[model samples]
Target: MTTQAADAAGSDKLDSGVLKVAGVVVLGAIMSILDITVVSVALPTFQRDFNATYATVAWTMTAYTLALATVIPITGWAADRFGTKRLYLLSLTLFVGGSVLCSVAWDIGPLIVFRALQGLGGGMLMPLGMTIMTRAAGPDRVGRVMAVLGVPMLLGPIGGPILGGWLIEAAGWHWIFLINLPIGVIAFVLSLRILPKDKPQPSESFDFLGMLLLSPGLALFLYGVSSVPGEGTVAAGKVLIPALIGLALLVSFVLHALRKEHALIDLGLFKNRNLTISTTTLSLFTVAFMGAMLLLPSYFLQVRGETTLHAGLLIAPQGLGAMLTMPMAGRLTDRIGPGKLVLPGIVLIALGMSAFTQVTADSSYVLLLGALFVSGLGMGMTMMPIMSAALASLTHQQVARGSTMMNIIQQTAGSIGTAVMSVILTNQVLNSPEATAYSAVTQGQVPASQVAPAVLDQGQSSLADAFGHTYTIAVVLLALCLIPAFFLPRKRIEKAPDATDEALPVAVGMH
Candidate 1:
């Protein structure tokens, strides 16, 4: 915020101008986070309308994620060099443009390409939002500001599918992308009026090599995750081998970063005791969270013989659970520290996933809802503390890299979670022995025409005995998350900036 640097210089007040800016950023954050899940409900419709395979339709989501992961490491420099306002506005423009382009796409190929562009824009919003909120509220007020920001973060994914399901059924898939236009337009216009202008300051050289290694590494890794479902064992290896290669590149990037004067992402952030532990827990949590999330819809669609809207609606309770309890969790983390609260939250998540064990062809919907709510509550309680703890550990100067690293890990884990689950679910679904044995257990009497769709849940019911298999795996993930909560300290913690850390202006990044 070098342009407004003079205005904001040396002042840590949390009143008037700063608070107003914070409100606007929150609105923008909602737009960014909500868009990620809003597309979930729309995916079924997109596949049907485009006459494409599930593999092709998935990129509408996957490409957006890949694009975001690829570009986020560079954001600190982009913000530092371009000023938050300029970069923020540009990100808004690009997102809005991508949304409009996505609405007009004639085929799966073009739509996915366009969505990646949208992700390119959307990815910057959260980090930028964090930068703005943190800088405005200052260090002392970070917890409360983050708690407020958590609303959209938790709400977007929780509500996205149901909202998109209703919208797609009522209107069409195209409207999903079209919905972004007006909101984006208003955000763009208001941004010009209110966002602080920070001029680019000359500083360290951009680490082209680190980024080069990191980007393709992430791209290939996600690509492999997406490809795993379709490529059966032989075909799966074709995709996985490249994924291994991609990881090797990331390892090379780490080595390259360790040796550099300034890396794309500063490896030094990891040396902080709390940062290391917090991020480790976060990655595990994401794997469990995302793996369960990915599994639930497949359960409904395949085993339950539900419509897309029906399947989407059934999953709403998880989000409901999260929204209901997250604020309390955030405030609790602030008051009691993350340690006391997170363990119970992880325990709740295990309970919630256990509830899934009861789900079968004839399982009660009401019971499923209860389980999801508890699961959501647990995730709600767990995610924010880990994040708050991590953020609490960082100085304003290190916040950008810290946030990117967290985001990257969460994203990567999500990709891996779904892939691993897919392998489990798919292998079971396809095996004639398991499939036939499952089919024979309860509903063996049905004719082929009477058979439920080979979707995840219906497939399970067609073979009713396999429900425990998936849930068992989910429980292991939940327990794994709980085990690490021990590393968190028991009281509200201080992030005393290290003496060795280089000092820089930790200005708010606005666009």
Candidate 2:
């Protein structure tokens, strides 16, 4: 082929058609991700309405997450058996229907049940969305298309609280869920109108044993991790017993998966060097990044004395920084590769996080916000580009399986990261005399004005130090991300034309 023809063939844009499919996927993902955070603001309301303790109402979030872990393992298999379009529409129906039920729930018990139902539907949406987008974009355009799909994933944490608080104050708590009605309707309509018909491959039999082992194992492990924040230690029986049992089961499943060819999740995909390296990079990055992302809002609320709404609003800069860079990162990843972008992204994140390592009681908002924006820029460049690298070289046949595995890793790693960070911060605050005193003031056990000015100042400073210590750990973890990122593809890799995916060659140089 001539030079011009080669260039023409290589340039793959996310045209109008691909954008439409992406729109549908994003809508579904927003509903799923936003629901998790939006409901977080309503926990207090549930306590008053149902006359239940915080522990009882806490199940509202736990149930949804556990349900998510359980169903995610099966999505790749279901997508293959039922077809992507059909499975996607079904997930939407289940999520929307679950939302309607949650809105009308008479008590917390019913609400928790409804949320689990919602999670079962929500869990499948993400991996399935990835499968659909990847197939639609083809291997060459995966980077740019994934960047479009990433908008909601990055913004949902910031936007959810703001949206939830406004809706609850304006229209009461029920609207938190009822709000999904309109968005779901639009997404469902768009899916029907825009998505192409499904072509399912039903020949592969289901791995029933893998399901029994892995799903329960994931749910139990996550349950224990999620409980650590409430229980305040991993040693609590409620945390340890189930977590140990879950770990054992997971080990068993790994052994089983290696022996079984069509495992519930294909462990064999790890053989792809790009996928393996990207998965490691993703695990480390998500753990550090997501753990710290939640803490930024807490710093605003706890140390700076901001309201929940203001805390969320304060975190918006990070999202804005991400938006500015994500599109450019996506296009570049397609042309160059993820490695070049991801290392710089990790360095930027660590740089931004370093600002938090020295946080004070009265750290300048401008400085902190600027730090957040820089970290956001790093995030935009990092996340989807890593995802793009993982799936970009996957064979058409392996796309669904690869997407499933990555989603599970992201979810599990995020849970572990959040739990670890929370535990460290909680311990740090307990150890700090001033921070403990500040907690009393915030909780109304001690009046702020009655406390001496020196005590108040010392307390706030101590609390900020606790946050700083916690963030120091995050920065260290972000630095660790670079080790794996260095192994990711540094230049465009040409996929081998062979149909067989077993033992794909590791391409390591510029094309």
Measured by lDDT, the strongest candidate is 2
**Which sections of candidate 2 miss by over 4 Å?**
1-11, 444-454, 496-511
How many steric overlaps are in each model, in order?
15, 0
Candidate 1 lDDT over residue span 92-119, tens digit each: 8888899899889999999999999999
Worst 10 residues of 1 by lDDT: 499-508
TM-scores of all models? Answer: 0.88, 0.93
State residue 418's C-alpha deviation in candidate 2, in Å.
0.6
> How high is the lDDT of residue 76 in model 1?
77
- Cα displacement (angstroms), candidate 1, residue 72, comes to 1.4
lDDT of 2 by residue, 1-511 (tens): 3343233334576655567778889999999999988898788788888988877998999999899999999999998888888999999999999999999999999999999999999999999999988876667777888899889987698799888878887898899999889999999888888887776776489999999999999999999999998899989999998899899999999999999989999999888899999999999999998899779877887788887788788888888999999999999998899999999999988998899999998899999999989988998999999999999888877889999999999999998999999999999999988888887887556888878878888889999999999999999999999999999898885553652322111100111
